[model samples]
Target: MPNAAEILVDTLIAWNVEVVFGLPGDGINGVMEALRKNQDKISFVQVRHEESAAFMACAYAKWTGRLGVCLATSGPGGTHLLTGLYDAKLDQAPVLAITGMQFHDLIETFTQQDVDLTRVFNDVSVYNVQVSDAAHMENVASLACRTALARKGVAHLSIASDIQEQPADAAKRSKRNRPAHTPQDMFAPHCLAEDAELDKAAAILNDARRVAILAGRGAIGAAAELQDTARLLKAPIVKALLGKAVLPDDHPYTTGGIGILGTLPSQQAMETCDAVLIVGSTFPYIEYYPQPGKARGVQIDCDAQRIGLRFPVEAGLVGDAAETLRALNKRLEQKRDGEFLGTAQNSMQKWREMMHQSEDSSAHPLKPQRVARAFGERLAENTILAADSGQNTELAARHVDLGVGQAFGVSGALASMSCGLSYAIAAGIAFPGRPVAAIVGDGGLAMQLGEFSTAVRYGIPLKLLVIKNNMLNQIAWEQMMFLGNPQFGCELQPIDFAKAAEAMGGKGFSIERADDVERVLDQAFAASGPVIIEALVDAYEPMMPPKMPRDYAKNFRKALPQTPNRDLIEENVARQPAKTMMEAGE
Candidate 1:
């Protein structure tokens, strides 16, 4: 008979798990051995850190809509999985995390790596349990996978080191009766809104002269339906960051992303529209939305509880986004008035023109926006782009124009750093021959630089664009804007990222001059294996909001006098359009 660890691996295979990302440790030796024996059945991806394992799992789930599995040892290893597990939880991705605990007899005796993992994972997991016997392995593993898929969140299982080595059929000899086996089959029911609720939402949408649609990650697979709905309502579609690929940035009806990392057309649409159709997005920026009583609202979401959590809605359609939108489309009448959409599109055109000026600049130290735009222009048809948090996210949100068949994602709710590389790794592994790239800032990449070796080890061809600004640019700007404080403790010593990548057995390219940007990027992307392109971006390039707030302007002015690169900041700020295209008498 197989051991308990073999039983666990078999159960995972039954659920169709193709790969597991993790690192080996003494606590998980049995599981590691079993994985080695079953190498042909289920692949093991060894990451440098346990955190990256969890992150890779989360990204795999997000992109493939399959259950992502990760494993680690007890104590610090289990604790390291928290950030990525929380990212999975907050972003509603299905992930299964397995960790090995101390020996069964050493429990509560404070042995090495003896931390109680189930209790540690309590808040982050939808289902959390510890296996006390070998016979319970299959049942526990099945339940974890089921719960993760059913709830679209994290599920964790902790197995004692000794229990993992026992015989799989140990329960047959014991007096304890075995529980019924859980099936591996999983399916999502097609949920739709009631006819009455659909009618109410349709009426509100049809009655309004100017309608605006805010699409989030929930609207990802419903692009055709969303486009049809937008065309019928003659509405401008504004995307949240996570939903950046729902509609291409160049789509005529789309005004691009909303909020700080968004476009002026989106802000204008939200401010002026008479009705709002919110789909699959719980964007937290309330101030960027229409005033409470100004516009009638209709929201579609899979979770009923999140319906009115962000904004008051006249109708809440609790169902799948595509199904609800398709049902609601039946009730909506085609709007002939093209004024709202026309004006928004015109503003978008002007905004793109203004953005082009920045992206086409000839500054000595390259502008971040220019790098992002060049990268966007070079993306392959099916490339998966992962962006790290901070100024890199802002740059990508503003400059990257995703093409059809491409996908984009960031750490939406958690906003964690060091996720970009892991996300790209997951994408590379999930789709073997597909292109994968990560846009990351110098500060963010420094946190998980070891993962570059992991990419080399696995032979996953990941292209990473590191914006080498040598500073925590976002936090520095926030200090000035929010506290009127001068830049302090934000500067970073420069490191040659290209050289570092070359040392890790991967191709490396560097871009220091404005003229070298396109050539170096082309060379990097054309390379056979993993590549890293380190672009020396201007540190003083300001990451301003689409519409600068009065208080923010005041604070910026107050902090300017003492800022280190005040002259450069002022010059860059002056280059931006003083008013939005709509506000500039367009």
Candidate 2:
């Protein structure tokens, strides 16, 4: 009979888990041994930190739409997994975290590294359990994976160090010798929209003169359906960042992302639309929704609880995003008049103009938008861009066009920084032939710079684009915009990131001039192994929404020329052309 650890690996293999991300430790020796024995069946990725293991696992799940697995030893190692696991939990990504614990007998005896991992992991995981008995290892392992995939959240399994090496057949079997549960057989199909729900939603869309559609990650596989629905309704499509891939940014009806990282056109569409259809998105920002009672709303999500949590929906369709959209498309009457779409197109044109103006800047300090644009232009059509959370997200949302077959992933609900590098690493592993780039700010890069070693070690060929602004630019801008407070504790002494990459045995390039952006990026992209590019960008750039609140406007004006950099605003304005071109096919 197989050992408990071997049984655990077998169960994971049966569930189709391809790779496990983790760091080895003494407490996990038995599990590690099992992994070593099964190396040919499943792959293990060793990362620098346990937190990074979780982060990579989360990213792997996000990129592949499958359950990502991670492992760690007891106590501190397990504690380190919490942040990344929380990232998966809040983002609704499925991940399974396996941790080793001290021997079960030594639990209350003050054993070294004897932390109560079960209690510690309770909050971050949807399902958590400790496997103390060898016979139940398969059951616990299988259930944890199933629960995570079913609930679309994090699951935790804690195995005692000693029990991990015990024989699985030692415990009593059931009377009939029933087979173990297979996830594929036990998994429930996603809910589909009801006929009445679809009809009601279709009627609302057909009656409304102006419509807006919001798509999220749930709409990933339904791109053509989403586009057709948008065309039928003559609606403007606004994506939550996670749904950035649902439709190309250059799509005539798209207004880009909504909220802080949103475009002006998208915000206007939400405010002015007569009706809204929210599909596959549980975007938490309620303020970004159309004002209450201003527009009728219909929400479609597989999870019923999220149907109308943000907006008051006239009809809530509980079903798969694609399936519901397809059903609605069949019933809804296509709008003939294009007035609403035209207005949206005009606004989108202006938004694109502003973005282009920023993209084409020749300002002395350099424009971050230009860097994003250059990379977007140069990357392979199927490249994956993993962005960091911060002002860089704003830059990416506005400037990076995913229309050229690019895919995007970020620390969405958690809105955490430092995930960019790990995400890029996972994407590289997931799609080895495609280019992967992590667009991170210096502040975020500093937090997980050690992960650079992981990239180099694995030869993942991940590109690191560091916007070296030498400050916590997002928080600094927020301090000024929100509270009218001067920036505090946000400044950083500039570091030569390129040199640091060189020291770490990776290629590095540093660009301070606006003109050098494309050339340096091209060189970085062509590098055979891991590459890091340090781009010096204007520190004073504002990470503002399309529209600012009245009080915020007053505060922002008062903090005029926020950056000490002279002629920054004037330089930016002087660089704008007389008329903005409608480059996005408007």
RMSD of each: 2.0, 3.3
Model 2 is weakest, by summed lDDT over 10 consecutive residues, at: 577-586
**Candidate topping lDDT:** 1
Which candidate number has the best TM-score? 1
TM-score, prediction 1: 0.97
Q: Estimated TM-score per prediction?
A: 0.97, 0.94
**Error of model 1, residue 465, in angstroms:** 0.7
| Model 2: how far residue 448 lies from native, Å | 1.0
What TM-score does candidate 2 reach?
0.94
Return the clash pairs for model 2, or none.
none
In candidate 1 the C-alpha lDDT for residue 105 amounts to 90
The per-model lDDT (C-alpha) reads 0.89, 0.84
Q: Write the per-residue lDDT of candidate 1 for residues 198-316, one digit (tens) a residue.
A: 99999999999999999999999999999999999999999999999998888998999998888989999999999999999999889889888999999999988889888899999
Specify the poorest-scoring 10-residue window by lDDT in model 1: 577-586
Candidate 2 lDDT tens digits, 168-250: 67756566535465444345666877788788888888999999999998888889888899989989899999999888889
Candidate 2 at residue 256, lDDT?
A: 90
Compute the lDDT for candidate 1. Answer: 0.89
